[model samples]
Target: MRAEVGIKDAKVMGIGPAGEHMVHAAMLCNDYNHSASHSGGAIFGSKKLKAIVVHGTKRPPLHDKAALIEAGLRWRKTLQQYSVSDRYGVGHARHLEALPNNNMQSSLIADHNRGFDHNRVTQRPCFQCARLCPWDVEIGEGEFKGKIGHFNAGAEWLDTFWNLGVKGNATLYLAERINDLGIECGHFAFGAGVLFEAYEKGLVKAEDCDGLRLEWGNVEAIDKLLEMTARREGKWGNLIADGPLEVAEAIGGDAVKWVVHTKRGVPAMHDWRPHFSNMLREIVASGGMKPQGGGAANPPPDLKYREKWGPLDRDDPKGWPQSNVIAEQYRQFVGLMGGCWFAQMHLKPDGLNSVVDSFNATTGWNFTLDEAMLAGHRSAILQSVFATQRGWIADHDWQQVGQRFIDPVPDGKFKGFTIAKWLPEMVREYYQLSGRHEKTGRPFMNTLVQLGLEEFKEWAQLD
Candidate 1:
């Protein structure tokens, strides 16, 4: 598409053949690696659109270019210090041993990354972004020899093994393949894991699986299934093509029990039976967008509202609500000035203040921490309002969570613990702290007025 348009640097975002068919887990891929949700692709397909290409030649005016540069320098320099200048790359802090395998039957796996490199030279930094997270790599001697893949997340290549019950270069190769095909990898991996578990448990036979063995780590079978999903081929393939919930339902007989999802989308694998704050993030997010709840667990020391929030307890929520609210507010505030969430997670608590200084310097709008936090809370409430209007009662929706996650961790560091015990209270706390109703999570009429979002009063049912 870029070649035809005569713009070599044209940014292209579009669907693949499967997405064009409007398959259930269809997704949009931009450039080489960046991707978005299933419905995003389905929407493009629904309108017979294949891709949107843009080539920007004009630079937008900045409030303070020099100040922004200085902020950028602080962002980079501080990250360099915090990273130990040595711990920057894919899977740097990853615990490959803790990867969930075989549909959460076990939370441990032998390291199977297959010579995956994490050298800074392999780093694929974004356009003037502070974090040196993403990576680009070339395969030298494998089934995928000579192929180079552009992967976005620091965990991009690794998540394949995390999601699929597989190992090694095949997982990396699979990531590139599906990325090219433009189907969301996490959704595809979840569907594959469910089928693998079902096959292991005899819920489905090879005959029923369209003649392919659905055993765990069967890369060939996994590849074939992905092909069928993209094209919606055969019974199992067509079923998977439909989407996670749909495919699990088609498999029937406890297959759905193996799924761990929210709002119909299967987020990337994290057996959060152990990580309470992480689970809280998944449960409370309006659209299941992974709400960066991990922010609460390792909050910046200098979070403006730190004095008000309590400490985080990994296995409990007594202090979770307030801490998470501050983290969420800070996250939204940082995002407004175009900051990276993942990068901040690694910073010293004091390093976060740099982001604030950067924001104020760039905008010449020196928003005190309190003023910015107010805006952040408003942004968050806006999401709650949207979810509330969708009939998403906070507590009720949690009951619909997949059993795989709600069940206690069978093994691993968080062994035998489940966030389920405190989830309802946690959700309620999250709502109350965010200025929503104590139980319903909807913004109160006056709360809306305080946030300058009174336009949502009627929609929030607080009119």
Candidate 2:
């Protein structure tokens, strides 16, 4: 498609065999390694559409080109000053003892530095990104020797590393191989971890896995399983393709205990147990287990949330209301502007004022911070309504809460803390603050009317 469309002029987005087979964990990938990973790609594949290509001759007309350029430079400068760079790629998380190990059983890995070396890794930033976040790594020795692969720093790299490294003890080469195959790494890891747990309990036998040993860190078996899943070749592969939750249900018995996911799929790499705001965001987000915009990580320093909530404690339930309010606005702003999350991280110190200025400068709209925040709220409400229309109402949102996220961290900095006890209250606070039904998670009639979405009220049953 690129060849026919001319490489410079064309941009293409498509899914792989996993999507073609309607695998639940499938994702869409474009030219610059950007992926709509959270958006299920199987929906497109189910329509029999292979790919979409765009060749645009015209650029969008900016309200003030000089102002936009100046704003971009300022934003870039702020990001460069504040951005966190990882030296050892994903392995840096291990050094901080922050990497999720053994399917989130713990956060620390004692010997995570075994295979990763600074010399073997090179930083690779995305297009137009000020933060040099991603890495191209080479494995000097191991089963995956001589193989070079690309991985994003922090969560993206950590997910693959923890899933394969901490859980299976697999080499970094295997993780890179999976990335190349276009499989969703987090989902794959969750599925693999479930199978490993079942194997340990004798629930999954050798014949069930097509004569392959179902053991942690069995690199060759994992590779074969990934292939089987993509091709839908065997019983195990076919089952895993459906996703970890479905696979657990099919296996029955105690296997469900090993599965960790919400309604949509596996949670993103971050563990919510040690962070109350993160836990609330995970539970109340429109898409199941999808990362919501505002949380403890991107708190507006200028905001009085600190004065109101006192201190930020991982277990404190007091922070949820303020956190939810900020997150909703922040996420909305990022989505509307087509800006990355890291940009939000840097501009957060100035609160929404910086974001408002950028938006106004780009479009020549004189928007106050409150108006800009309402735009985000409007978008969030629409998304919630859409999810409700699809039968994923508030009642159904908490399906995986007890099974996956409620458990206390057995060890680490957050030992003995459980988000389960406080989840209901936090969720209620979120719904109330967002002007949605606390129990149903549906947008209130007033909320729709306020957002000028009065026409959608009846369709959403809010009328």
Candidate 3:
């Protein structure tokens, strides 16, 4: 709400200072986007408006259908009135298609600056409490005029929505989160593990790490190491942001090939090399130098390659194809609601359709399930084109996460199994089906324009 309102002292959970600063008009978190620790919205503020907090007792209803049927609609409303953010509940997306940023979009210019703040807020919300509240709006006195910006912290590794249910171990945390059955963030652990090994090998001594020991299997030590790395605390810390690949080259170690990163030196997930197709894509899509083009986080329900082998069992084969269809549909569902993808997973197709019905009842959009999928696919394709311009390819071996399955499972229930060998053919088939280039690994230009991304033709100079 503060973001939409430009309230300097007002803080919304899960936002960075960069987001807080770029506000003209903001939306407060409604029942759908508000969480126990966070709120999403557009904000506005005035010259003298230090803060504006609209508190309420609305809680999300419980997910138990039997309980809902027993409690009745009237009872659910009453329960919601007193709901706190901590309670477990699922809320559907409410399409607020009338808002700015294509119903809901962040300032691209601000996002880059807000990277640190995003990380900070994710790691610890306390950072916001300290500095988020106080800001000087340069707008002269007016009802809704001010240059607003908040003191947002950086991104936290655990701030990702999917990490909510996983165990937290610093050394293995990256691996767990990246390989989350419900989510996928591409391969990041290969580099993290390598860094840990480097530390153990005395490559990064105590002095390089600012007195912190980078021992293997020590969560505390790894956590401290990450903080230092994120903060750039010591000499090595300052250079650490260069990422594992660069670090390996600079330090003169045999770690570059194993560093497995996309363009920006961010390491590929643990399974980079073994999945050569993915690695190839990672290398190509990442500007052939940087390594950030790989997909960010994907929801658990979005895991498409469940058959390749992992700890989780497939819920139903019907869902395999249905799941993709649903996933595509859900994206459109979020666009209508003006919600983030991280928050959209809680609303499956059926649940989302219910919200659309509510919206039509209130505002009369008459949004249909088919319409939702079209919107999502259109938007997603645009994003895919952007990835292609940045160098996505079908043959990149380092980009995919399935490469990790080549090695036998070390200690899990699926131990000693190597699915890596089977991943390429499967992923390649997926690529072919998805309409990627056969040799260059880029998406077909027609696909880009088809997805409402005509701008890419001009951007990439493609005819």
Candidate 4:
């Protein structure tokens, strides 16, 4: 296909056999290792669509080509100057002490530093990425010795390292192999952890996994499971491909306690116990379990809230209203513009005027900050409505607090902090600020009307 279509002209979005077989954890892989890893791939496979190939020669109509080029150059300069390490930091779970280990069984790893040596690793950025956030680790010893593998050493890296490294007790090579598998890391971790737990509890046996010992960090077994999941080969693979929530229900007997996920797939790798807002954002937003937006601490100097609310507190419910507003705006802006979040976060202190300017220059939409925000908010509402139509009720929108979060942080700066206590307050504040019903998480009639989404009011059944 690449030869016939020409690689430069053809843009392909494809799925593996797991997606072809409608695995719930199936993901769409595109060029540059970019994936839509939110269960949409299964739908495409179910429709018997192999791949979506785009070959376009015509340039998109730009309102002002010169202005757009100037904006691009400005934005690129901002990104190039930004220090990714200083902003988000590096190291695979080394900095975070409360990194969830062994499926949230413990928060601490005795020697997480030993999991992956920084000396043997090199920075590998994504396509045209200035940050170079991902890591390419060279394994010096073990089964995958001398193999170079890509690792996302950001917020998402902790889950992969924690699950395969600390919990599975696997080597860095195993983590690299998992990354190569192209499965959602969170789902893979949860599935592997649950199966291991089930085996430990005598709920499942070696025979169940085709005589593969379901032991922690068993490379052969984990590797086999990954293959089986992608190929949808056996009963175990079939069950696991369905994701942790379904697997738990299938296994029954106290398995639910081990699984961590919301109604939609596994949430991102962050343990939200320390930050109450993380939980609130995930629950209220319609994008499934992904983090909604950037953090509130160190507000961009130009953020209007700096003048009104002063310094923000992540844990304080009073500050969450403005925080949620800022988060929603940023989330919406990124979604609409298809820009990188890291760039937005790093450049935020300059405010979102740049985003608005770039967007206006490209699309010829004379939008002010408020208008741009409304556009973003409208997108969120549309997504929320789509989710609602797909049977995502209001009650199920919030994070399902499990035993992992229920168990207080044993030791940390925020020791004994419980997400359950502050969740409701934060959620309420988020709804009030975002103009959604506090209980239902639906866009209010007034909100719809205000956002120029009055046409969708009836379909959304807004009151």
> Residue 456 in model 3: shift from native, Å?
4.2
- Give the TM-score (vs. native) of candidate 3: 0.48
- Write model 3 residue lDDT over 308-427, tens digit each, in one string: 322222221212222233344455456545543332322232334444444344444555655555566565455555665766554554344222223443432333434344444533
The deviation in Å at residue 238 for candidate 3 is 2.4
- Runs off by more than 4 Å, candidate 4: 80-97, 113-129, 134-141, 151-158, 164-172, 205-207, 285-291, 305-307, 399-401, 459-463
lDDT of each: 0.67, 0.65, 0.34, 0.63
- TM-score per model over all chains: 0.89, 0.89, 0.48, 0.86
Give candidate 2 regions above 4 Å deviation: 80-97, 164-171, 286-291, 297-299, 302-310, 346-348, 459-463
Query: What TM-score, to 2 decimals, does candidate 4 have?
Result: 0.86
Prediction 4 global C-alpha lDDT: 0.63
lDDT-sorted candidate list, best first = 1, 2, 4, 3
Comparing 1 with 3 on lDDT, the higher-scoring candidate is 1
Q: Superposing every Cα of model 2 onto the true structure, what RMSD results?
A: 3.1
Total colliding residue pairs, candidate 4: 0
RMSD of each: 3.2, 3.1, 15.2, 3.5
